[model samples]
Target: MVDPRRFKSRSAVNAYGGLGIGQSVTNWHVVGRSRASRRGQRAVKRVLFLAGRAAIRGDNALARRYANRLKSGWEDRKAIRDVARRILFVACAMWIRKEVYRDELVSVPSPTR
Candidate 1:
C-alpha cells in the first residue's frame, strides 16, 4: 500500500508533475491548431495514460464514466484527463483504507435534470 498523505488532493497530484494538466494549446488557427506545454514526468504520465485507456476498455465505473463523458460531448483529452484524476483519487482512498478497488464504490450517478 502507498501513503495516502503523500497527496493532499487531486490537484496536488496534477501539480506534482505527474498528470498532464500542464499541457496547453500554443496556437489555434482557422485551419488548424497547435499544442504545447511544460514537460511532466514522462514515466508517470505514460503509466497514468495507459491505465486510463485500460480502464476504458474494461466494464467498470471508470469505463462507464468515460463513456458518459464522451456522450455528453466532452472532448476526448478532457475526458481522459478526468478519468486519470479519478484514478488518482481512488488510488489514494484505497491506500488509506487498505482495501482493494471496487466498482460499486465508484458508482456513476444517473443523469438528472
Candidate 2:
C-alpha cells in the first residue's frame, strides 16, 4: 500500500484529494462543466478529509493546536485541509522510514509570538 504508486515526495500524497480537501469547486474557469478530467482518487480524498475532521474533533491536543493555529488566518475547512496535509506528510515519512507513530515526538510550534 505504501509503495504502490512509488510516490517521489510528500506532495504526492496530496494527489489523494489533498488539493481539494476543503474546496467546494475545483474548477474555476468552467462553471457548468470541465474541459479536462480531474486527477487523484476521490475515495482517498474523502478518507483524508474525514481523517482531518477526526483530528480536530478528537482529544489529541497536538492535532488540535495545529488545526487551531491555522484557524487564525484560514477558514475552518481550510484549516482542516492543512491538518490533513500534515497528516499525509507524516504518514508518508513514517511509511518511508518504517517508523512507528509516537504522538509525543510530533511537536507544534506555539501560535503566539
Candidate 3:
C-alpha cells in the first residue's frame, strides 16, 4: 500500500497556512453565534476549511452539492464548516472501520440494489 497523502508542490501543501482564521490554536469561530462555543485543533480546522472550499470549487462532487445545500440556509463559510464537520465525521467513521476512503464511493450517488 502507498501513502495517500501526496501533494504536487510544497507550496500547495503550505498554501493552507495563509487560509487560517487567525484565531488561537485551541478555538476558532466559523460563526460567532450567541451562547455557541466552537473549539478544535486549529491546524485541522484550517485543513477542513480548505478541503470544503476545494470541494465547492469542483462542481461534480457530491460534497459540492452538499455544501451548496447548506449554503442556501447559511453563510458560505458556515456552509463550508458544515461540510468540514461532515468530512470529519466520515473520516472518523473510516478510521473506526479501518477502511480506506474512496472518493468514487463518496463523490457519486448510486441507485440502491
- Give the per-residue lDDT digits (tens) of candidate 2, residues 1-113: 43724876555666655453233354554345322225677676677778878887766754766655774665666566667666776677787788887776556656653
Deviation of model 3 at 44, angstroms: 1.0
lDDT per model vs. reference: 0.71, 0.62, 0.51
TM-score winner between candidates 1 and 3:
1
Cα lDDT tens digits for candidate 3, 1-113: 02214434423322332322223333554444232124434676678778877766765454655655664565566566555655655565575568987665554323222
Candidate 1: lDDT of 81? 72
* Colliding pairs, model 2: none
Decide which is better by lDDT, 1 or 2: 1
| Candidate that beats the other on lDDT, 1 or 3, i.e. the better one | 1
Q: Which candidate is the best by lDDT?
A: 1
Give, for candidate 1, the lowest lDDT window spanning 10 residues.
Answer: 29-38
How far residue 112's Cα lies from its native spot in candidate 2, in Å, is: 5.8
Residue runs of model 1 more than 4 Å from their true location after superposition:
20-40, 107-113
